[model samples]
Target: MHLKIGEVSTIVVSSPEVAKEVLQTNDLNFADRPHQLGADIMCYGSTDIATSPYGGYWKQLRKICTIELLGATRVRSFQSIREEEVSKLITYISANTGSSINLSNKVAAMTSSITSRASFGVKYKDQDAFISLMRKLVTLAEGFIIMDLFPSQKWLHIISGMKPKLEKMHKQFDMIFENIIAEVEKTGGEVETESLLSVLLNIKDHQDLGFPLTMNNIKAVILDMFVAGSETTSAVIDWTMSEILKNPRVMIKAQEEVRKVFGSKGYSDETSLEDLKYLKAVIKETLRLHPPTPLLLPRECRETCDLKGYTIPVGTKVIVNAWAIGRDPEYWSEPEKFVPERFIDHPIDYKGFNMEYIPFGAGRRSCPGISFALPSIELCLAQLLYYYNWDLPSGGIMENIQMTEALGSSSRRASNLILVPISHNHV
Candidate 1:
């Protein structure tokens, strides 16, 4: 469907076939990210991977992302970090056993800490403030304000007060990054291993890439990792848990699978994560239903192209509604239901192929942090189900759990999920 919103030509793709045509068939034609006001200010000229216009520079950055930054090796190197944090979450839940606890906050903090330690080899002194700042930035970065819709109206930004808000947020963001970078530099590589920041700093100092890396580039890349890794991963895990709690049968089956696979050993680890087949299926179904970004980051057309007989002119903004496509009845049987069994032996994966299930999106601009995120998500969920039998807080019913989608570009739950935990007998 085509929409003309304040001079911006917008095209929305809500069908699997159309999504494929746009994301894969003519991937190059829509390789560039649309210039949005939030990215322009927050990402320092939109130099980050998600906002960068498609070009040789973008390609170079992507290459580094896939091979060095978020490669198999780099993701694997963070295993211990994931284990420690997830274990802490489990311990916290256990300590508060029987009383109501805020699972949403606990999970978010756990994931953010893991992302921070993996990035800087340490956690921030004011971690809570940092998380709050990230939440605000993500909401703004969705670009829903009037200023974004009418980009040509430069003076309108000031009148609406959007410019000042973004400018203030950007300074807070920079100050945080500056302090962290300075701390990392003072260490002088004294740490035994290189953090993600260290890797970027190393590459920048040596001018090791075809495209030079500026300080802004480094900061922007790190921001991308947090938004993708910490925010998205935590939200997915939260949704998966909510779904499981609402469906007792799913909860039982998932727990059995996690326990049976990691049982006797009483632990979750890289070696055992693959064996939790049903658990993996649970995650797939969750993503299918609650993709963090219902509509993925927009792509700008680089050339005129024919999309399933529709003429898409150059410069039109393209948005693939993963939420709608994932729920299309034509592609999925009982699409609205949370049935992990449907995916138990299913060949469908979310890695862009089979556009019907693109949780992380498809094609050239798909999220590159999947390798960096899935482990934390899988590990946290698997452990939560493995060690405890969860219960709704006193008098709370499964059906009443707030499954309402919160407003914003991010599809988070409107309410914090509260639950009671009971230790399980592994034997």
Candidate 2:
């Protein structure tokens, strides 16, 4: 689908074949991200990995992410943090058992705490401040500002007063991150486990890649981790739980699988995630139905290319609707249903292959936090399902549960998911 938003030519890819062509075959041609007004103001001029233009700097940052920041070993190092946080969540739910509880808020806070400890060594005193700023950033980044569509109209930003608002938010975030950096520097090599911040600070001076990372670069990367890691993971988990609760059979089967895996030993850490195959499928199905980033970050055409014989000119903004692609009836059977069994026999993985099921996207601009996120999600979901059984707060009535969506770049349930918890011991 091709349309014109002001002076910008926009292409929306809604099919798997075209997605493959754009995200894989001709990925380099559309590798660059479109510059958005909100992203420009929030991402430190697109220095972050998600918004950075395709070039040596992006390659270097991606290399640092894979090799140093979000490597397999580094993700595993945060296991204890995840376990502690999951325990906290379980305890909170237990206290509120037999009454309506806001599962959405609890899960979001849990993920936020886990990301905070893993990234900054300790939760910041002003953690709520960070969350508030991050919510505004996501909302703005996903918004369609007039200045973004009509890049030639530079004066419109000032006239509309959006630029100043963005600048104020950016300054507040800068102060918060700068204080975080200062505190981390004060602790200098004294911590047992290395946070991502420490690792980046260690390499801030190195220029082997022909470009040194500035403080802004480090801060931008931190923002990427927080924004991508906390909210998206929590949303997916919330959606997965909602699906399970709506389908009693699925909830029973998944819980049985989780319990049988741990058997006598209860609530193990991420290491046990490998044994929960059914739960894994549940998550995959949830992501298929509800990808965290539905449209994904927009890609800018870096060079002229012919896709499906459509002469896509240079500088056209490409939008691949992963949400639509996932539900396309051509690939999925009864695509609207939450059927985890579909993945039990299928060989689809989240590594962005096959194009038919890329929740995290594919190719050069694919999300790099997958390694850091998948385990956290699986572990968190496993613990939640293992510890207790969930019921809709609607007095044992299942139909009252609503699956309505709030769509954007980051899609979540339109309303908070409230559920009543029943302990396994009581059951």
Q: Using TM-score as the measure, which candidate wins?
A: 1
Candidate 1 local lDDT, 1-427, one digit each (tens): 9999987899999999989888998899988988877888888888888888899888988887898789888888888888989889988987898899999999999999999888888777767888999888877766577866887888888788888898899999899989887877787766535688888888898865766799999899888888998999999999999999889889999988888888878776667999889999999999999998999999999988888888888999999999999899998999999999989888998788989999999999999998899999999998888889887877688866779988878889888988998888751
- Stretches > 4 Å off in candidate 2: 394-396
**In candidate 1, residue 398 scores what lDDT?**
84
Q: lDDT for model 2, please.
A: 0.86
Clash totals for all models, in order? 0, 0
Which parts of model 1 are misplaced by more than 4 Å?
A: none
Worst-scoring 10-residue span by lDDT in model 2: 263-272
lDDT of 1 at 25: 89
| Residue 92, model 2, lDDT | 86
